[model samples]
Target chain A: LAKTTQPISMDSYEGQEVNITCSHNNIATNDYITWYQQFPSQGPRFIIQGYKTKVTNEVASLFIPADRKSSTLSLPRVSLSDTAVYYCLVGEDTGGFKTIFGAGTRLFVKA
Target chain B: DVKVTQSSRYLVKRTGEKVFLECVQDMDHENMFWYRQDPGLGLRLIYFSYDVKMKEKGDIPEGYSVSREKKERFSLILESASTNQTSMYLCASSLYLEGGETQYFGPGTRLLVL
Candidate 1:
């Protein structure tokens, strides 16, 4: 299992773009970068995932450099409802299994 | 859409009492996991199962035991509940190891041990 590091908290205004970065210096070759968004009292929801380069989805985009040691989760046009904790994980895509969730980045979207 | 259902949404138990937390996945996933979420500590894995009756200890398995008698259900047991054991219990299900599918999580069970 690979350990991950992310910001403890962040603040963004409505309609602004927000990007949260995660570092996994000890990342393994078979590992993939996946991001999840969790609201209060709700289970974390899958946002985006990437092996390398960029992977985009309907909710967010994941940008991973060639180094694969770090990745960024970009949320476009943030809304008040977007205020939540975002988790970055590095693990083998075994059914998204065997993942370690770090402290995660808490994003506060203000109107 | 994958549906992972937990037996209870909230539970309150007393110390030294036996407790059971049940989780079921309708997707027929072969892998199920139990995790606990705390304030300062992130999510810590308590246990996981690859197949029916096959279980593995996770990062923080102390005082926690799991059972998987059927393919779609996994249950976490606390032999004797303690105050520190009170936390948000999460259950997740994933496809077999070879499939590399994403794990789907249930709504979670909030356990408050008095």
Candidate 2:
């Protein structure tokens, strides 16, 4: 499993864009970057995933550089409801479906 | 929508008592997992099952055991509940995908052992 590093916390106001970057220097060739959003007292929810370049979805966009060693999760026009912890995971079929999640980036969306 | 439902949202148990956390998924996914989340530890996997009656130990499985009697149901058992075992437990299910499996999680069970 590739170890990931992200910001401990980030502050953002409404209508502003929030981009959280994750670093996985040991990323493997078969690895895919995935982002999950977790609200207070709730399980993490899938936000966006990408292998390389950029992938956009209804909720957010994932920007992966050519090197694939890092990825960014961009949330447009954030709101207070978007305040949550975001986790970045990297792997694919890690023997016996073992997945690892690191301490996530806590995004605090202000009014 | 993929839905994973846990038996309880909040549970209080006494020390030395047996505890069971049940999780059921409606998607019929082949893989089901149990994870415990703490203040700074993030999410640590306890156990996972890829098929019925087959189980695998995760990173932290010392105090936890799991049983997957059927495809949609997976249960985590705590032989003797302790105060240190108090934490939020999350259940998830996913299908094995070539790109990456997207895990659907439940609301989580908050366990308080006193």
Candidate 3:
């Protein structure tokens, strides 16, 4: 499993764009970058996933660099309800199955 | 939508008492997982099952056991509840996909042992 490092916490306001970056220096070739969001007292929800370059979905976008050493989760027009913890994971198959929940980045969307 | 339901939302038990945490998924995913969340420890995997009657220990499996008799249901058992075991227990299910595997989680069970 590739160890991931993310910001402990972040602050954002409504209508603002929030970007959270995760570092996985030991990322493997087969590993994929995936992100999840968790609100208070709720299960984490899947946001976006990508293997390389960029991938966008209805909720957010994932930007992976060419090196694939890091990835960024970009949320547009954030709202107070967007306050939650975001996790970035890098793994494949069974290896990915483990360590799905590391210390995630806590995003605080202020009013 | 994938729905993972836990047997209980909140549970209170006494020390030396047996405890069972049940998790059921509607999507019939092949993989089911049990994890415990603490203040700073994040989420630690207790056990997971890839197929019926098959189980694997996760990062923290001490004092914990699991049973998966059916595809959709997975159970986490504690032989004897202890105060140190008091924490938020979570259940998740996932299926392997092209891009990656995404886990669907349950609301969670907050267990308290005294």
Candidate 4:
């Protein structure tokens, strides 16, 4: 498991595009960047994942630079409901079965 | 949708009492995990079970033990609950993927040890 660094908290206005960045200085070559979202008492929910460049999804977009040292999670047209802690996890293929989460970035979408 | 069911949504236990947290996943995922969440500390894995009767210790397992009698059911045991053990416990299930795969989580079990 690689240690990740993300903002403790971020505030954004509704309908704004929110991008949260995570830095993994010692990211391994085999590691993949995965982000998860969680509400107050719920488990973190998977948002988007990427290995390099950019990967877009219906709910969010994951931007990973070529170096792969850092990644950003982009949520388009955020709403109040999008307020949650966003976690960035870096893990290798554990025979295809496990990913761990660190303290995620707390995202607050204001109206 | 994959449903990861945790037996208790909220639990209040006395110090030195034994506590058991049960999680069941309908998806029949190959892996099941238990994590505890705190205010400043993010999520910490306590234990994980990969197969029936197989278990592994995670980052924080000092006061925890886990059992996987069946693939779909994983249980966390607190031999003696303490005030420090009071926190929200989360259950998750996932299938292996080539890269890091997504993990689906349950609502959570809020345990209060007094």
> Which one wins on DockQ?
2
Q: Cα deviation of B82 in candidate 4 (Å)?
A: 0.7
Q: Please write out the lDDT profile of model 1 over residues A1-111, one tens digit for every residue.
A: 889999999999999999899999989888887788888887788777778899888898888999998999999999999999999988885543578888788899998
Stretches off by above 4 angstroms in model 1 are A93-97, B96-100
Where model 3 places Cα greater than 4 Å from the true spot, the runs are A94-96
TM-score of each: 0.96, 0.97, 0.97, 0.96
Chain A (candidate 1) TM-score to true chain A: 0.95
Q: Candidate 4 residues B1-114, lDDT tens each? A: 999999999999999999999999998798899999999899999998888998888889999999999889999999999999999999999866665677889999999999
Summarize candidate 4's per-residue lDDT along A8-67 as a digit string, tens digits.
999999999999999998888888888989999888888888888999989999889888
Evaluate model 2: give its TM-score. Answer: 0.97
Model 1, B1-114: lDDT tens digits are 899999999999999999999999998888899989998677888999998999999899999999999999999999999999999999999754432357689999999999
DockQ measured for candidate 1:
0.53
Clashing pairs in 1: A95-B100, A95-B101
Residue-level lDDT tens digits of model 3 in A20-92: 9999998988888889998878888889889999999999999999999999999999999999999998877
Runs with alpha carbons beyond 4 Å of true place in candidate 2: A93-95
In candidate 1 chain B, where is summed lDDT lowest over 10 consecutive residues? B94-103
- Better candidate number, 2 or 3, judged by DockQ: 2
lDDT of 2 by residue, B13-98 (tens): 99999999999999889999999999988999999998999999999999888999999999999999999999999999986676
lDDT of 2: 0.92
**What DockQ does model 3 achieve?**
0.67
Q: How much is B68 displaced in model 4, in angstroms?
A: 0.3
Candidate 3 has what TM-score? 0.97
Index of the highest-lDDT prediction: 2
